[model samples]
Target: MQSNKTQQGGVLGVFPHYHWRATEQEVDMAMPAPAPRPLRLNAEPQNLVIDLRRTAIVVIDMQNDFCAPGGWVDHIGGNFAADRAAIEPLQALLPALREAQVPVVWVNWGNRPDLANMPPNQIHLYKNSGSGTGLGDPLPDGRGNVLEKGSWAAAIVDELAPLPGDILVDKHRISGFWDTPLDSILRNLGVKTILFAGCNTDQCVLHSLTDANFLGYGCVMLEDCCATSSPDFCTQATIWNVKKCFGFVTDSTTLLAALQAPPA
Candidate 1:
């Protein structure tokens, strides 16, 4: 009697083409690709038909430090309320995106505890006066270091805490791609398009979106899902730049509708 046990191939990565399965007799490299999940989104400048299978939503800096009371923004007297606006929209949109099988990437400022990776310029952004609480500085109420990894200042807000399947990337620079594993992670996941959302639209969000654009990824800004404490003009300018130079601009409502609509 012949043995019934047979060798089985194992998947190498998230993508089909790049990964392979190997057995005792043969190695199959041409795995069947999943069908594209295309959705039509109404956006500024023009409309778009994105493949959800190759797309991911990047939520930037939606952490306690930026949105919650007794955090960095609040401690500095910045208008934390403005940044809080993105919370409700995100609450509604993230679950829908997850349901649609779209990857959720949370890119927050999580610096090293020793501040060794930080430069003077980056530190100065938070402490322009060369005094007071800055990056890696302990909060007044002892809420751990500002934006330091594993600290309350670096944790995501409770309302928008990442679920088990969500991806978290700690970024030390304004651009999430700079000196970070974000690009590598997206590449491994076979993501070609990025939907941008989060706080300080003109600063972190805009810079990250621009970096994504430069890296040849399709960029889309979710207007209502991003907030800023800056003047209204700043928000306007960021939207204009995203539409004219960087990428398309749309809101979560439009995206949610697209996700729910039957694929055309």
Candidate 2:
């Protein structure tokens, strides 16, 4: 290794070469963070396009058991507010969507009386999860029973109650399509695009959305209208994955505006 450190008087060693210092020039190249994706805005990443006219709203697991106080959510030590947060946005979005003639489908947890078709793993998980409640368990207030078909606790919230023409599909698993007629109903209705909103964004909402995407349905997640009892990171990660892979992500405000916006 040779040393070239003996430069003297702004000159290179043994040569009259001058030492040159280059000045750094400022650049106007500050890249700003991208604007967040808007609600109900049609974004076609990976060739997925959302058609509002063909879209149906699927509200997942926003039943009394999950959102109402003294229901399974509160019984499981979950913050009621976390599950209840979606109510207002859903209430606001539903009327507009209904007026637009979009079909409203409620996918809820409604198990059979015999629990004959219930999976053992799910039963064990919920029964031993320290909530002391399981399928067919009586709710605290006795207004309805948990997971029992046609029970009040298994019903949708009053604020966003289904109208006369709305469809109701009972689901046994986290994913609405698992052992349910949700897919058949949507397909029969000629629905190709689905907008999802409801409780437990990371669990039921994520599962159902993934299933819908897998079934080749264009999915749009109503971000503000989907919530979870888990930490915020869980919901954020769900939204990220949805936008990155599953489908589009938007909020209620943006969705409402998009729904009300005149066609181009």
Which candidate's lDDT is highest? 1
Give the CA lDDT, 0 to 100, for residue 224 in model 2: 86
- The reply for model 1, stretches above 4 Å from the true place, is 1-9, 14-18, 24-27
Whole-model Cα lDDT of every candidate shown, in order: 0.89, 0.77
The CA-based lDDT of model 1 is what? Answer: 0.89
Instruction: Estimate, for each residue in 156-249, the C-alpha lDDT of model 1 and write its tens digit.
Output: 9999989887899999988889999999988877789999999889999999999999999999999999999999999999999899999999
Residue 236, model 2: Cα distance from true site in angstroms: 1.3
Q: Determine which window of 10 residues in candidate 2 has minimal summed lDDT.
A: 14-23
C-alpha root-mean-square deviation, each candidate: 4.8, 22.5
TM-scores, all models, native as reference: 0.93, 0.80
Clashing pairs in 2: none
